[model samples]
Target: MHLWYAYMTPRTIVPVIFGLLLTVVAVEHIFTMTILHGKSMPFSTMLLSTSGNGSDLHCPSVRLSARVLPQIALASYPGSGNTWVRHLLQQMTGIATGSVYTDEDLRLHGFPGESLSNGSVVAVKTHQLYDETFYDRTILIIRNPYETFLSLFKYIKANHTGAPIIDKYITEWGSFTANEIGHYGQFYTSWMKHLDVLPIFYDALKQNLTQELHRIKVFLGQSGIKGNVRCALANADGNHLRKHSAMPLDFFYSKEKRLAINLLINQTRKMFKDRFRNVSESMGTWML
Candidate 1:
């Protein structure tokens, strides 16, 4: 009876240990989700939702271009709504968008062609200012630097998830604002100098999605797009887009930081006006 009891104890203890480990892992996952996403959901449901299964959201079937396409760049600074625009582009064109950097979350979500920059996809996403000859054409998306900095800070803090900035990050905001302000100004200013570039404002895109999408479609030289612009407009806020919850400027930045950001904004507006003299005043008004 003693020999039998010893063998049974080891077997039972092994299963108990395995079960405890799994429970710990599950709890940790739930905690992370709550912190990052602002709510705790069932693990299976989270997986299904993120993977685009068992959900009501419209997930477009995106594919690589049939033929080798030109290496068109969708360029922007970090937190400039580049991913949202990519979602729109993919929906409208039915062609997959490639990114210079591989994001596993983005890859699993919808962007199957996450890291192919060889021009098989319609356009490749890039945040850096590449050489003039690298891209056949470029689409530069510019957002307000103040908002851009805040969004980027939140993104980094949440480990690149679509999470809002929590109060715990207030201490870090000052330093982050100081450092990123110059880079934000430089990214748009340098990219605007590119001859084969079409500049799009992030605010304008949100305000007039259909019109902006039509403008992009024409620029991409797609005379007949596979996906409907109307449908794309209806589903503009796809899964990839982060919810825009506007916090007061003072909440994130000091008066000094605001002044610095405003100066850069004015300089960028002047540079943009000088570069694209013929662009409509309405199109440029968003900078103000």
Candidate 2:
């Protein structure tokens, strides 16, 4: 605290802090946009390459495994626990899943998914829109949208290294919330329309790991690996995730604010009502 005060006072800090913070946020935003569109570009060439015909964009060469299992796409809105799924699945199969946004934790546990040339079957996890060309099968994971946004808010806060960035985050909260809600709604509606997708509900997953694991194994044609479920659960440690979702009651701050948020969630639900009504028990955790 003393060291921080030596460099500046509160009056001199906001602009400098906002500038640096905005740059990081902006670059990360660009990265997410490109990854969502391309689903597999390496960072070095993500914004660099173009198609031969000059009308399209092509990602730089990725060294891919010649002998690989069917590629499965594990996808969800950001903060819907996509990384957790990768960790568990990798533990179970002794194979790694890749992501568009590389995580050091994933690297420590398995391998960087974008450059996946490993001979084992690999799952490519992403928050990208449903891209048919990216995988042979798809897994779409959904959490309660309200909780998803709230978790995302906390996640952005967690990623900051020095002082808290809550002020800036709150300033930008309206934009962030709008984009996330709209994008996830479209993501759910679009992906669920597909005939091949295997859906996983985040809350249900936390409630019953064994059941979800069995279902995923069957979906990925790895039913033989069912025995690895316990080890995978033990290794994945889902309880840690539960703590992340524990927001204080006053987090929303006002009854009116909560009502508005609920209204937005209701509209989103109605947008996909026909598709989700029958599957509410499994997919509509947001309704509760």
Candidate 3:
């Protein structure tokens, strides 16, 4: 009786212990290699790239595995035309508004909706700064930093929800261009440091949406994304794009201020022409 009980206990206990140990080791390895390795790009890069002129930053040519075709993230800061790009891409790629997913952390009500995973290729819009610790493939969209700040300022001033932090920027309006102004400064710094990901100017989206859309389609194609993704991205009509909703110029400023800001934005954007062309061409031409 004792020998029978001993044999049965040993047989059952050994396999259970072995299975548990193996599971723990596998989990530890996955955490160490994937999450802790610092191999993926951080969301911070997306936010920072929108702050200033980072045209000269050297970036590695983005490479993706042929099997995955890579996920494309439309990264930028607030008021930097992310939604506009989304509107254009959704129409171009046939990604329904119902299909586009908002950032999980920023979702208004903690509602879990459809993840970008349902589609073969995921294109997300991000407002986080780039940090090389998260994100797979980043496509940065930039607006003039001054205008970015001005728009934010106007939005906040209009909303005025009694938050104390609002004063930090308002009080230092004159010092906005200084390095001390972190909100927009970090964006400028990041853009200057990373050049590998493609950068699209807000001005370009406004000036010649058709050409820029074509350039974007080419970039995605080079990354091995095809079929529905490619066709959806390349299908935007500039005329239709011009009609998309935006932060109305009248939201915070008089007509004169809006015109002046527009003029300034155009003037500064002209300085970035060469950089835009270089980045776009490097991504190659799409069949569209």
Candidate 4:
């Protein structure tokens, strides 16, 4: 009798333990799916109810514009604070900004309108130079070439995260600068020639965010801004903003490299000055 009872206990206990383990795994999976994908599930509902705090399940305030909008291009060279600008625009307008390419990170972060470029979103981001037929207007954000290069370098090294680049890549800056400088110049030059383009300098935007945002708002004709401009200003530096230690130009570039960058900068500045002389005069501001 004693031996029979012992065998039965071990067998029953094993099945019970296996069942409990399976239940735990199922609950864990449901919770994970609910949090990441925002799917509603029976277990997830119960879990949230018990926890009494469901802020983690909240989605960003940004939503698709109810009315179809014109396809505006948010054009910029890589690493020119384009993401930051998109954040500000979405936060201010409560409209999701689109991108030609669907960046999963940005999609998960706050850009629910990523990869949507069918005139539904507020604006579509693009690094590539597109023609007039593709977009109604272009918002070109240009940064200092030197700083832009460094930011791009760090951004690539950090794998698109906001983390700082390791010091080891400092040695590679010269070749990187040489390789990318021409492309940067060409990108700006091409966009500058676009018939309907609003060129906004990165420095100017940073210095006067409110003014810049207001200008952008007017350009986009976005009268239904759901978010307060003051609130957007207060939270200007969203999680997407990357903070890097300031390194001198000499630290990243040799004299020759610096000369090449300066020459391009000057040429670009001249082109801008020549192209926008009338507009600058009218606006009373040469934003280079």
Using TM-score as the measure, which candidate wins? Answer: 1
lDDT of 3: 0.47
- Relative to the unseen true structure, what is the C-alpha lDDT of residue 235 in candidate 3, on a scale of 0 to 100? 30
CA deviation > 4 Å runs, candidate 2: 1-66, 109-121, 160-165, 222-227, 238-246, 253-288
How would the candidate models be sorted by TM-score, starting from the highest? 1, 4, 2, 3
Instruction: Compute the lDDT for candidate 1.
Output: 0.73
State each model's CA lDDT, in order. 0.73, 0.60, 0.47, 0.73
* Cα RMSD for candidates in order: 11.0, 18.8, 16.8, 9.9
Clashes (backbone N, CA, C under 3 Å), per candidate, total 0, 2, 17, 0
Off-target runs (Cα >4 Å) in candidate 3 are 1-69, 96-121, 154-181, 191-195, 227-288
Q: Mind giving the per-residue lDDT tens digits that candidate 2 earns over 1-288?
A: 468648897878888888899999987887786555422334354554333345433323223334556657788887788767876775566555676665564454334454342235457777777766656677778777767776666667664112235685568666676666567667776676555677787887888888898878787665232335544654455222424534453463345545555665676557545555544533333533
Consecutive 10-residue window with the lowest summed lDDT within model 1 = 43-52
By the lDDT metric, which is better: model 2 or model 4?
4
> For candidate 1, lDDT tens digit of each residue in 1-288?
466446566768888789999999987887676457432133244421232243343334577877888888999999889888887888677688999999998887777789988767878899997668788788888888877876787688774456644664666777888899888777877787577878888887877887888788888875233455653554467675655556665666667876787788888888888898865534333332
Each prediction's TM-score against the native? 0.74, 0.62, 0.45, 0.72
> What lDDT tens digits, residue by residue, belong to model 4 across residues 1-288?
466446667768888789999999987987787567532234224432211242322223567888878778999999898998888877667678999997898888778899999766888899996676788788888888877887888788785655444564666766788899889878877787678778887887878788888788777765343454653554467667777656655676677887787778777777878877743312222212
